[model samples]
Target: MRKLFDDHKTDLLVFGGLILAYFLTRLPRLDLIPIFTDEAIYLRWSQIMAYDASLRYLPLVDGKPPLFMWATSIVLKLFPSLDPLLSLRLTSVGGGLFSMAGIIFTSYVFFRNKRISLLAALLYLVVPFTFFYDRFGLADSLLAAFGVWSLGLGALLVQSIRLDVALILGTAIGLGLLTKTPALFFLVTLPLQLLLFNFKTSGWKIRLVKLFLLFLLVVIISQAIFSILRLFPLFHMISQKNLEFIVTPAEFLARPFEFFFNNLKTLLTWEVGYLTAPVALTIAFAFLRGQAVKQNLILAAIFLIHLLYMSTFNKSIFPRFLLTFTPGLLVLAAVGLDQMSTRLRPSLLVLVFVLVLALPVYTDFKLLTDPPTAPIPDGDSKQYINAWPAGYGVKEIRQFLARESSQYPKVTIGTEGTFGLMPYALQLYQKDYPNVEIKDYWPLGETVPAALLEASANHPTYFIIYQRPDVPPNWKLRLVASFQQGRSNDYLRLYQILPED
Candidate 1:
């Protein structure tokens, strides 16, 4: 057993097996949740892409990138129906599975220890947050997969200065950027690494200058190609949103301290929630004392820079945004655990095992069973039936709708709050009912009644209202069913041209 543990090859296989098991557990349960709002957008947009050329446009929320939509477009082409919860979500699942492989490979490549890489893989596979997001229809998992690969390639280039590695690194970075605009955080850290790596080379200044020009060239070329394909849609959107989103230099200058403080707080809130103080300290300690000082420092810088960027937004910093930094944290956490594994005596194995088992159990219980605080002022009512699409209800809702419903020419679903998982679910369910009509709306929006009104005009027989009871009484609708448990609730309401009342 000791000898087996010592062999990295064996450890890698063991870890890979465990990850395979993890993916299996989640993949089979893919469409378990009701579709959430953002997922609805992606599903609808991608479905539009299936027929109309104009609908290929990028859908940006909060200045985020168009990569997820672009990827979703590709999946829609393959499946055609574009099931938000199942078909579309499967892409994320595949991306996540590959990301697990990337995590293990990147750790092995960086730390050069099978055990440490395995430890990192174990940490990633076991984390409930990681698993929850992995199965959902989102760009986070896809971005993370590419992000880890980009960072690994960049780090490898820094160590070797090989032209081929640099080219590959550049490509990965470009793809990552394409995945999410925030991936600029990784790209930002690369040149610094290049300068550090080549500080001793002949004509260091020339090398730096050449590196800068090459970086610009690669960026320009990639953007130009994507621009032509996206037809400069993203740039146009930026120009359109500039008045609303852009901050003046004077504003930033005037509140420099306050800006920095607030940004740091937002970043820390989600990060700290995921990693407790002890884990944070452990990762920090490893950075200070680890052998790969330069690489670790770069990782730390990336984490800090991203936190700083995310903090500037005035909106509430969701914990899911932390997904962008998952690869970095996972790598660092692996290093931290490896450091502990080595420093601790072999006699302490049992104590470590107990800690390992205890943590994930506690986290899973909290994530799966504990309902989130409602979006409403009164905690008695839940705004969203589920915050994310990783529960028994989510899956049940998908299957029930898939099995029971027949396709309509057009249909709109009224939902309270943002139901990110619905579009994906509809896409999957629609496979069995090709003529299904599905559109999404948040009940709080002025547009909620528009769908019901449209349905009443056409008198579409089927209605799937996520918050049926909570929908305003003014809306011409009657509830057929309400799915509720604890504080959470979802409903299905139907409407007609003539009021029964």
Candidate 2:
């Protein structure tokens, strides 16, 4: 062990620094940002699954795979005393760190250059897209990590034909599939390995047979593990829910040209432009210079396959969907930098790195200081703060409920959403408080629910409004507390219902 450490001391030191940097950026005030609706739903599912095994298939009802929630449940069970939401976020942190390591390994495997590998890892460490999602309590980070490692191990397996690498790759692929639906993209991109394979080698026939067997082994193992999702009846819901996002074959065939053009426009302008500007520039430069053209083309093919798959299927493209290819982009960018450094001056490479990273680093700084009001586009901080039914005012509202619970025998709170962040956020916090009864009132614009009005006639009630400012004028409620984003008039209001005689 000492000898090993001594031999790779530089690598070890660099990794240590990267890990520290990751934690510094991810761990401090981990729960500072409000719990997003998805985060709340995921955490609540884990909470349910931790104690009850029968409900392990709960996330499938919402078209979600169960790996992230399962992992979260295990963490919560192990550390029962820790903050539940924070524990869930920590799982994503683990996934992010593993993803960084995977980036390094993948870069080394492909380019066989330590400088490019290290640079890829560094870029992943600091990129705002990566940094923000790594801290978030979502399955995207985990999916990205597993997808990256699977691709890396798949590359190594193709070269070495090692059983151990095959097993690891299969496991990573399985986990990725179980994490989210986008893992299918990794499988879709796997065929591009044919471009990387050498056909002119000695004993090519035998080598191809062995490679085929290994590939089959990986698919079988991954499928076997994935079959666990089918244990519940709601497993079919995954396919059903997925259909809502994607156009049917008949619909696509009828409007193929229109569908293709629209998807292409959205893909280039929004998905690719927003998340991978630097990587795209690097690819363009590589193509222009005709450097590593074959490898770059292969990478581009993989990226485009994933992009086109997402564009075709994703009705509403979210920023998080792009995470599956983030490591690939970073690796390509690293290759671009390394190649450019050889052609141009080394200082020019540094300048390119600085320019590429400037905006992302600044955005990350904003997220760290004031996440709720960060000026990041399509970020959880800005997007979910006051607009979404997240846990922005949840902590404050919970405090109010706790205080009121002591004064009254029973306190009831009605939230704007049924199962989303509002009521679920309060539900997560108020689990121990048996005196508090949390209810949901859906369809935000409608008048106060008759049930809530009837409940208010019996006792004092509170209504939490995140969707709109005004409630019915006849409801006779006073605004007790309001939580606002920094310097923003938009806020979540909690109103206390006045008792009616």
Candidate 3:
């Protein structure tokens, strides 16, 4: 172990610097992106799991695996002083750091080139894709990290044909499966590692048999780990929930091109915008490196196959789903960058590299300072910044309620929706104020809930609405505060339900 450490001592030191860079991108103003519906839901689950032992499986109620929440729960426990939302965001930061390291190791392992590896990590550091996602509380970044690790370890297993490597690879995939259902594709793609196998070597027959055995061990280990979810009957909800986001096999066969055409168009827009069109264009230069064509083919497949498959059947697709393996595209682009560094004239190369790096760096700046106008797709603004689902007013609402509770012995709050931003986000901050009582209502009718009216008799009762188009006249609501969710005209309005005269 000491010898191995000595051999890679420089690499280890460089990686420490890279990890620091990652946190610099992640840790500042972690809540800059307002807690959206999903973050609210996931972080709320993490908060619940940390407080209630029996509810460790709470996310399973929504068809999500418990690993990201479980991990976030640990963060919440350790950093009790930290904002629970910020603490939970650390989970994605850690995952991006892990995935950055995986990019370095996998690039180096595949091509035996330290320059290519360093470039890969550097690209990951600056790319808008990682920059935007890594700093948020989401499971996609963690799943991407596990997917990248599995890629690196799968390569090692193929080259060494070792049971130990397969064991490690399977463990990574198992953890991924425990994070998101999309990880099952990792299990499906593991066999493609044979593309890296050395058929040119002598004693090929025995090596083939050993490879088969090790591969089978990998399947056994990953599937066995996945079966842990089966302990709870809600595990079946995972498959059921999947039907909501993807075309079933039967649906796919029936209308393969129906959604595929438009979905593919949207995905390409997301990829080009986030990937930075020039950086993606440079991936073509990877072919110039003159390594085994099969090696490049497999690496490209890491991103390509997943994109195509998701485009084919994804009913509820988002740019984040592509994050799992799109860093592989960066590994390929890193090779291209490395090759240009060697082949181009010194001055010309500098110009090319600077131009290539400019957009992603600028995009990162916009994302950190102001995301609504960032160069990425409008979809981001719709979901996270501008839409009803956005949490533009959530923090202010919490602070408002916190103050109201202090001024009065009892404060009653009503939020628009039951499950996500309204109730869950508000509930997360409800811990300290014993005087505050928050209840949720949905499907607003012509009149307010009688409970809100009853609570109003003695307590200051306030209701929060997010983009409720036709707030009922019978609500007798007076606007206490209103903030535009984003550049969009939609406002998150706080109204105190006044009792009738």
Candidate 4:
């Protein structure tokens, strides 16, 4: 044991430092970004699943798979006293660590260099796209972890044709598929791994037959796990909801290039924002260099096809969806960095990496300290930092209501809408507060309703509005507190409904 430790001392130190860096970025300030609309829904589902077996498949009603909720509910059950959203975020932290380990292992397999393995993890750590998701309480992080392991093991299976690798790879793909539908890309790109197969070896005919047989086993295993969803009646809703986000192949063929260029432009713009142009250049450089050409091409094809397919057919696309491609891209980028390092002096190599990684590191800093200033895509900024859907003032609202609840027999809280951030967020926060009665109101006319004024006459009633910019002065209400939702013009305003003058 002592000899083993001594032999791998440098490797241990490098990985140790990488793990420290990962936690430093992931563990702190988890509440920095407030709950999002989807988060409110997901966390609520997790809360439901944890405490009630009757509602275990609640998310399936909304066309979401139940695995992410099941995973999160375990955290909630384990730490019953922890904040609900915090528990959910910790689940994603586990997933991020899984992907980081996969990056280290897969990079070593492809390049056989310890430094490249370290560098790939470092890239995943620093890139804002990954950094943002790792700390977030979302299914995408776990889904990406499964996708990374699937690709890594698939690459190994093609060369080794081992049954153990095939079975493990199938499990990885199955978990990924349960997490999200994007795991289909794993099957779509599996054929590319054929480039790594040992066709030059004797008895190639039998080898090909064995490979196909194992591939069938993989399909059977993955599909069998997926079929568990069929026990629930709403299993078809997954495909139905999937169509809402992506265009059908026939639909795309009808207008082949209508959204292609614009979507690609937006996606590449986001890529540069998070990954940095220099790192992207390095990924390109990996191909130009002749080393590990087969592995490089396979990884590149997997990532490029994913981007191209989404760009060509997406009805709506967000940067988080691009996360599944990160492990592959970062590993490929690590290859380029490794190739460069081999030709350069140590001092020059350090200088090159620093220059290539500078932008992503700066972006991470902004995300950590001042999220509103981060260079994320506008859609992400709107969803996470600066818009009505973002839960910027949710904590403050909860605190205010909790304080008010102590003074009243039953504190009635009204929000702008019935769905999403308004009602769901407050619902999750006040799970144990039975004295609180929450209601939702929408389509506020030119003036506040007389119904509220009548209620205000008896006692002070509070209302929270988040959906719009306009506040009617004629609403017979006095402002209690107003919070700017990040840097946006949008504000979450709390008002005390006043009696008629």
Candidate 5:
């Protein structure tokens, strides 16, 4: 071990092991799970891009970035004869790999010890939450990759202070913004930190003012070009995805302290994923005391600010949002481990490290094997359901719809759930029949179209109504397929409105 450390190859071995573990744990049964509704939405948008070379509008379904869609589209283009759920999600795998790389690169920045950096990379790579989310066809993993890379590069820029380094940092941040809007935290934080650092030294006098002006000019120019290319509409849109809910200054002023407190509660106790108490505490201790811990601490602060913003409007503040701080967390954890080893026997240090990391791994493994049963006990049940929709039978419903749609092209579907799944179902099932057409009542607003309803009644088309039976219904619609999901049953009844009625 001492020789391995001396040679600086220990970190490489650890980083390689982490990459291996990530693939082993996440790659298997990738195709086994059902295509989630959100994944389906991304796939559908990707299909749109496959047809049109230029995007017509902001493909921001509920304010999500179009990068995921672009990713899916590229995958489909590369592998035309691939499964939508399985092939498309490889992009996320790519993102996860890049993020692991970021972890190693960032750790190498502060420690300059290859072994320590590799260990940090390994810890993040094997982290169950990281692996689980990394495999999913969501935007978080990709955003996380860009965010971490930006941080690592930003650190380099601070150390080297080269114009080329600035350009690289700007590009990484631009990509991150293209991935998710919240990533702007990093873009904004860098200059603010520089200002703060200078202010602390110069007391906000002549030197600080000059530095601030130069920093502001550089930031404005970089962001102006990045925003125009990525977001296009400037303040109107945010990289084709956005925070759907707008915030006002009044809202921020209304509860300044509450925002921080609420985010604190969520960050510590969020259970949709792993929140290993022991590891968290260890990392916290390192952040408070370790060398260069101030930067990591500030990153955590920025992440907390983002969490607070999400919590204010009751936005989904999943722990995945905290992925931006992952590199910092890993570094802090390494510092803590290094401290432990220094203070105690090597054997004791090993025992404590294993225990801290192992508990979360065990719990997350259970979640991987059996998701529904492994939800955070105190949090609401729906939270887990939203996180992993493979637990839901979205795949089964898609297959069923496909097999039935072959016989009739004009079948209409109605459901209370997000209606974005139908077009994706068509994309998935279009393997055999490439020219299949599905005319479904997907957009809820379209369901109430008077002219379309009248034409449907005259033509005598089938209505697939997925609604609760207890609710009041129209007399003309007839019951057909009733699917039960857990305690709730969705009635996919066939309804034919009578011409006279």
Candidate 6:
């Protein structure tokens, strides 16, 4: 043990610093940002599943796989006293750490260079796209972690034909699939490993047969684990959700070239370019210089396969959906940086690295400190707030409800949306307050619902309007508070309904 520690002391120190940096960025004030609509749904589902075993299938009913919610339910069950939002976000933090470790491992596997490995891991830690999603309670982070580890282990299996590595890789792929549907793309790209296989040895035919059997075994294991998801009656909903976005086989056959070029343009220019500009620039440079051609080509093939599938699918796209490809991009970028460093002096290389990474690090810092007002162009920080019923006024509303509950026998509160971030946000926090009855009123343009009107006549009723500036003229109400994102109204007008004589 002493000999091992002495031999790898430098590696240990580097990893320790990386881990410290990861937590420093991820752990502080996790609950400070308002809960996103998706976060609210997932956390609420976990809360339901923690107390009731039968409700484990609840997430599947909403066309989602149950692994993340199931995992979060276990955490919540163990630490019931902890805040649900914090505990749920901690699960994502674990996934983010795993993802960082996987980037380091995958970079070393492909390039066999310590500088590239450390640089890749550092890039993963600081990038705005990874940093923002890592803090939120989402399955994409976990899926990325599993996907990267599976790619690394799969590469090793192809090189050594080892059964143990095959088993670990199979388990990683299975877990990735269970986490999200995108994991199947990793499986689709597995044949690219043939490039890494050595053909110089005699009896290459026999080796190919063995490799085929091992690959078959891995697929069987992954499918067997995936079959567990079929136990739920709503398992079919997964296919339904997939069909909602992607074209069916018949539809694709008819319009084989439909939306192909446009989707590719959008993905390359906006999604990948905006979120990972430094990495994108490095990849372009590496391709032009013709360094690590074979490995770069293999990584490119995998990324292209995943991108083609995503782009062909006809639906609205999100940046988080591109997360599974991020580790591969970072690895390519690290290789590019390492290749560039070989031609430069040590001082010049350090300066170049600092300049390359400065923008992403600054973006991450601003996202953490002042997220609502951050200048990020394409991430959850900017998009989620403007698009969804985020919990901007949730903390204040919860406090007001707590105070008002003590004054009135029962305080009825109405929110704009029913199942999204609006009601779910209050529902997660106000689960203990039975006297605080929260209801949802939908269709923003419609007049106030009769239920709210009746509630206002008897008790201290309050309406939390998220989208509209105008209120019904008949209701005697006073605006208590307003929450805005920058100058735009994210949430508005916590109204206290006045009593009528």
Which has the greatest TM-score? 3
As a TM-score, model 4 comes out at: 0.95
Reference-based TM-score, model 2: 0.93
**Which candidate number maximizes lDDT?**
3
- lDDT score, residue 218, model 1? 48
Candidate 5 stretches greater than 4 Å from native: 1-15, 60-63, 192-225, 229-235, 239-243, 254-260, 271-273, 287-296, 305-316, 376-391, 405-419, 427-437, 440-472, 475-501
lDDT of 2 by residue, 1-501 (tens): 999999999989988988888788889888887777888999999999999998999999898899999999999999998988898999999999989989988878877889988878877877777888899899999999998888788778877888888888888888888998767766667767766677899997898899889888888888777888989888888888878777778877776554555666655664444344665576555556675565666667777887777666556566677787868877887787777778877788679878877766776787788765454454343455545445667777777778888888888888887887877888887755669888887765445666666778777688988767677666777888887744446678888877656
Determine which window of 10 residues in candidate 6 has minimal summed lDDT.
379-388
Instruction: For model 5, give the 10-residue run with minimal summed lDDT.
Output: 484-493
* lDDT, ranked from best to worst: 3, 4, 6, 2, 5, 1
If the candidates were sorted by their TM-score against the true structure, best first, what order would they fall in? 3, 4, 6, 2, 5, 1
Compared with the true structure, what per-residue lDDT tens digits does model 5 show for residues 1-501?
878777867546665677788788778777544455567777777766776866623454345556667787888888877776775678888888888888778767655766667667666765655666777778888888887777676666655545676666777777776667767777766753452243354345665565445445446644764455444343344422333343455765785455556755776676324546666667755654556655656556655666655666533355666666565666666767666766778888789978877877776665567554544333422432433222245455556656655766444443433455544554556654433333555333523335435645544333444433442333344554444332223323334434435
Q: What are the RMSDs of all candidates, in order?
A: 5.9, 2.4, 1.5, 2.0, 5.4, 2.2
Tell how far residue 274 is off in model 4, in angstroms.
Answer: 1.0
Error of 3 at 151 (Å): 0.6
lDDT of 4 by residue, 1-501 (tens): 999999989888888988888888899888888988888888988998898988887888888888888999999999999998899899999899999999888877777778788889989998888888888888999998988888788878877889999999888888888888888888778888888888888998898899989888888888888788888999999999999988888987788878889989988888766677888888876876688888888888888899999889897889888888878999988888888988899999989988988988898889889999898778688888888778887888788778777877767767788767778888987855557777777767677666666667765577888888777667766788888888998888888877776
- Give lDDT tens digits, candidate 3, residues 1-501: 999989999988898898888888778878888898999999999998898988888888989999999999999999988888888889999888889989998888888899999989989998888888899888999999998889889889989988889889889988999999888888788888898888999998899899989888888888899899888879888988999999988998888767877888888898878889889888889897686577688888867778888888888888888888887888998988988988899999989989999999999888888877777777676888877888888888888888887899999988888889879888887765668888888877789889999888878999998858557876788889888877787889999989867
Better of 3 and 5 by lDDT: 3
> What is candidate 6's lDDT per residue for 463-496, written digit by digit as tens?
8877666776676678889877433555556887
Model 1, position 299: C-alpha lDDT score: 70
lDDT of 5: 0.60
RMSD of 5: 5.4
TM-score of each: 0.76, 0.93, 0.97, 0.95, 0.78, 0.94
lDDT, model 3: 0.86
| Least well predicted 10-residue stretch by lDDT in candidate 3 | 466-475
